[model samples]
Target: MSKDDLKEAEALGRDLMWILGLIMHSGPEDRQRIALAYNQAQELVASIPKDNGDARPRIVACFERSDTYKAADDVACAGWLLTGMQERVNERDLPDWRKLRKIINNTVKMLTPPKPTIH
Candidate 1:
């Protein structure tokens, strides 16, 4: 990949991290944004050139969403690491930054589910 491609990938990584941040947040707005970012990140991850090893399967396994405790742990750990790295990339304001940020912010807002109000 050229320097530009590498930079683009890093920017995507940052957006992915922000999405993770949205996922963990209980806020309504951020929740939607997170969901959008999460989907986008998944798509981006899918697009990366496939290399040797079982990393792809393993990453997909994390998203499998099974009832098993081990499965949950795998997903959590892998997702956390990827998301964290993505955030670092996002901080740099690399290419494709605007669209990435906008989508993540919007998705986080959309992801919020209804909650009971305190009387």
Candidate 2:
């Protein structure tokens, strides 16, 4: 990858981190904006070249894992799980990171409000 590619990836990483922070904190009323940001981050990751290296894939996986947990009904538990996963990543424990990602992703399913039907 060229210098520009690396730079773009770094920027995307920052944006994704910020979006994740927002999503974890935002209320249900703010779902639309959070979802939009989430989609944009996914697009950014998708636009990066796959052959660049494993970095892109790893980063994408992190986001994908977090996404899986976004559906979790227990907000507190999901928040704690996310925090622990973040810590594992910070410690560079690849094995734990991978495992936590799967656990978090598989555990949560966002609770969506019901839509109104015509009478």
lDDT of 2 by residue, 2-109 (tens): 676456445434543554565556688555543444354445555655554444453545456555656554223233333333433443334334544544343222
lDDT of prediction 1: 0.47
* Estimated TM-score for each candidate: 0.32, 0.37
Superposed model 2: Cα runs more than 4 Å off: 1-25, 56-93, 103-108, 111-119
- Pick out the ten consecutive residues of candidate 1 with the lowest summed lDDT: 61-70
The residue pairs that clash in candidate 2, if any, are 71-109, 71-110, 72-108, 72-109
Clashes per candidate (backbone, < 3 Å) = 16, 4
